[model samples]
Target chain A: MEQEMVLKNENSLSSSLKQMLLKLTPSIKKDGIIKSLKNTGITLLSILMFIGLWQMGSKALYNKEADYRIEKALTERGEEAAAAERACIESGDSSCQPNTLPSPSQVWASLQSLIADHNLIGAKKNAFAKKMAATNEKMIAEGKDPIVYTGRASFVDIVLTSIKTVFAGFLLAMFIAVPIGIIIGLSPSLRSAFNWFIQIFKPVSPVVWYLLVFMIVKTLYIGDSSDNAFVISFISVGLCAMWATLVNTAMGVASVDKDYINVAKVLKLGTFQKVFKVILPSSLPLIFTGLRITLSVAWMVLIAIELLAQSQGLGLFVWEEFQNGANDSNSKIIVAMFVIGIIGFLLDRLMLAVQNMVSFNKNEMA
Target chain B: MAYLELNNIYKTYGEGENSTEVLSNINLTMEEGEFVAIVGFTGSGKTTLVNLINGLLQPTSGEVLFKGVPVTDTSHERGVIFQNYSLLPWLTVGQNIYMAVKEAFPKESKKVLMERVKEYVGMVNLSPAINKRPKELSGGMRQRVAVARALAMNPEMIIMDEPLGALDALTRGNLQDEILNIWSQDKRTALLITNDVDEGIYMADRIIPLKPGPNATLGPEFKINIERPRDKTAMNDNPEYKKTRNAIIEYLMDIGDERKTVSDVEYKLPELTPKSFVA
Candidate 1:
């Protein structure tokens, strides 16, 4: 009966569903539910232990004496003020203490408040748009341009801005690196000529690149503007992030199999056809590897560039919160940290998906 | 006039004291529509000779003439089936053939190209694997794709550098017949470079043995008088097949013995200077 069940499962129309059902049953088989349950139970238990430890540690470190002072200040006024002060202390207000680390509950509440703040901003944007629609229609009738809203960007908007900056930087790096790499890779003389430049520039930090870009942008723009900040930050990010891709692309092109080149030659392909058809396809796996590294570098460099340039992005938001030094600022910063990490992971997976689509060598994926 | 000629070819690598001569005094000629096989041991510069004929490599001191014109660079007139198959792994079997067909006949319509690709794929008996990449196919199937790709271009000459050297005996025999079938249709000028004696006698009208190299050269040509559509079993019983095979084997055995003595003498190291120790 068990053998029949196994065979049926193997030949099932929906094998994924069958597998899931099998995983839910408690059995000694390798793919059974017991193993999955144990794995999940261990993860949950560890997380619970960590939270419990954190809560206990926080209580021990917290200064109730600081709360007592604020309580005494309120009690000196009246019983009603004393009651309000106790409520405030219970509410975990940040103003009562300067150096207190937020408990997990406090951080959670901060997250909820941030969401509320984002929603409130969204409602304000909607109202502004509605109000502007009427004004814009009148302005159009009167042959005048509509006024654009200048509301403060929310946390979600800042995150989007950071994503946009990184993508822009990554694209710029690809455009600059790939063709140059291919050209250098094709000729030994060109590679030798550019070797010094690549070596010298590849190790330069984002800060140094930002300073160089800033000087150029300053001279070119001749005025302080938000657009200039955007240009400087992204350009700096691109400059700093492009080296890996450039080096990898050149290496990839240089190391393509000699047989493939001979095949191209025997086919009597033109230079363009040979490069596009044979060289590029064969070198694509390495090029995609370079691109993935370049993207990660671009993301890492973007934050520093944004912070240095005072641009409207997650980096700037984090830096501003750090400078503010409010009690909730630390929680918000932690939130941004998680967001950045998750986005970086997603970007890597995205590149991996694209690499799989283009590369023929499946073993290389591992 | 000879259709393809290599006159006094001498190919060497590196320069001056570092240079090693590979092919020396390699003079050869083939008539139009003739099938020739060059038999040689491994590392006897057979591939270099094939490369020279295909115009992929320039001779160090000789000219390769195709139809009385000097062979300068590779052209679609000579299609090569490399030993390693050399099908681009990213392209499907049909696509690999189509790439060559499109390059050879740029003026042909897309439909015509597709039809030609399908026809060639069918010719190789790989229609089921038409859309499969080279990596997905076995060695025999990849070699078949390589053959189809070369034949699809309809080149004036087909140069194969031990194309079936890597396959099992059964697959090799099957492909040999398939290649013979294709050659019979158009009778294009063909050259096969291989060390397999039976394969040479089976496939070519003329077989030339290549001597072992420090400077490899063609030894002698043996003409096969066997008729077409020759059955393998029947060839074993044929007097001409046995005589030709024995003569070629004898020649190869003589060269093998000669190579051992030549290498023993050639590879002596220079005497090292002895260092005097002070007391």
Candidate 2:
């Protein structure tokens, strides 16, 4: 009787399941979901472990520094002073802080503090715009320049500026590098002539490029354009980062398949058609590889250029926070570092996606 | 004047003591609508000879003339099917042929151009793979795309340089029949370079052997008197087919033996007297 009852239940389930799943293959969706869930769990666990290790390290350093302070007090001012120092440190006195690596909690606090500061600045800017609106309108009607609100950029604003500068620099590099590369690649004499030039300039430092750009930009702008810093930073970034793209594009174009060239010749293709159709298509994978390198280079050089050129960006934020030396300055810097790393990783993934779409030489990513 | 001619062509590489004469005094001529095959060993300078005719490589000391004009550079009039498929990996089968068709007849509308591509691709029985990239297709399929591309150009002279050399035997035989059918339709002047004796005999009006190089030159031409639209199975039993096949194979064997004899010098073998253990 129990067996019959179980059989009846099984028959009902199978009748419904058979309608839903017509194919013979097993449940792939369920497997995929389980696999992804496992991966996510592992990722979460590893991150938790990292945070625990960091907390331990931060506490150890703090204690060591605190102990050193207490020992110094004992030697210099005897037992009473040592006792007082210990009391001050234990009471969370800012003056007696044991400056060391900030714990994860402190970094999280800094992130929240940054968000609040951004909100405060955002309100101030809105108020400023409200105050300036009438005057700016009047000035515009009178054929005079509108009054602009100049304020300190928030952390998010600064990051966006860095992103914008990197993109501009990347565009500059691609434009300047690709055309010149194609020309040099097509002609053997030009390649030979430029080889030494490329080798010499390829490894130039960002700081040197920044100064060179500053020298030209300073002369180019007669007055306070306020765009000078941005122009200088982006130009320096382009000059510093373009070498990889230039070299790779040249190599890619040069190493286009000889068979393709023979095909182009047999087809009786014109110069323009041949280059665009045959040469470019065949060498695309290498060119994209070069461009990927160039983008990463542009991003790397942008930070240094921004710092040197006094451009408003993440670099400036980090530098200012470092110089500020407040209680939470180090924590803020740590937050910025993580943000930079994550953004850089995302940028690389973006380029990889683009490369796979365009290259046609498909295999899994290296 | 002959439709196409090679006037005592020679191709040499390097200079002074290092110089090697590749093709020595290669002379040939073909009238309109003739099929010719140059059969040779694998490493014999057959490709060099094809390149010379197609104007991809200049003959070191002579000339290739077509229709009483010096062949200086590649032209649409002379379409070549390279040994390697040479299909652009980025383009689909249809696009590969379309690119050639567009170049050959630039004034045609897009509609007409596409029709021609579809027609040729279908002719090769690759209609199913029209949208597939060269990388996606098998070796024979890619080669068929190449054949389609060359045929679509509608060249006066078709130069096939061992185009089916990389395929399996069945595929090779199938492509051979397809090419022969195409040739019979227009009787387009064609030059086939192959190492396969049977391929040469089956395809060409005249079978010429390229003597293995150092100085690979064309040997005496054998005019294949076997008629076409020739049936493969029936021809095997025919006396004329037997006679021609034997004669060509014998000539090829004799040349092979001669080359071997020239290269094979007898060396005195050292007498292997086992060294005495006392020594």
Candidate 2 structure quality by residue, lDDT tens digits, A1-366: 533343354555577565345233235534655799999999999999999999999999999999999999999999999999999999998998898899999999999999999999999989999999999999999999997768889988998999999988988998999899888988999999999999998877889889888998899897875568899888888888888888888898999988899999999889999999998887778778888998898888787788888899988888988999999999999999998888888888999999999987797446
lDDT of 1: 0.90
Clashes of each: 0, 0
Q: Which ten residues in a row have the lowest lDDT in candidate 2 chain A?
A: A19-28
Across residues A1-366, which tens digit of lDDT does each residue of candidate 1 receive?
563465455564466776666556525444554578899999999989987887776665565655666568676887787677666666868565535555677668777888888899999989898989988999989999887677888888899999989998999999999999999999999999999999999999999999999999999998655478888888898999999999999999999999999989988888999999999999999999999999999998888889999989989998998999887897788778778888999999999999999898978795
The per-residue C-alpha lDDT of model 2 at residue B117 equals 94
Q: Give the Å shift of residue B151 in candidate 1.
A: 1.5
Query: Model 2, B1-279: lDDT tens per residue?
Result: 999999998999889999999999999999899999999998889988998888899988988999999989999999999999999988899888999999999999999999999999989899999999999999998999999999999999999999999999999999999999988999999999998988888899998999988899999999988888888788889888788889888998999999999999999998898879996
For residue A152, model 2's alpha carbon misses the true position, in angstroms, by 1.6
Write down the TM-score of every candidate: 0.88, 0.90
CAPRI accuracy category, model 1: medium
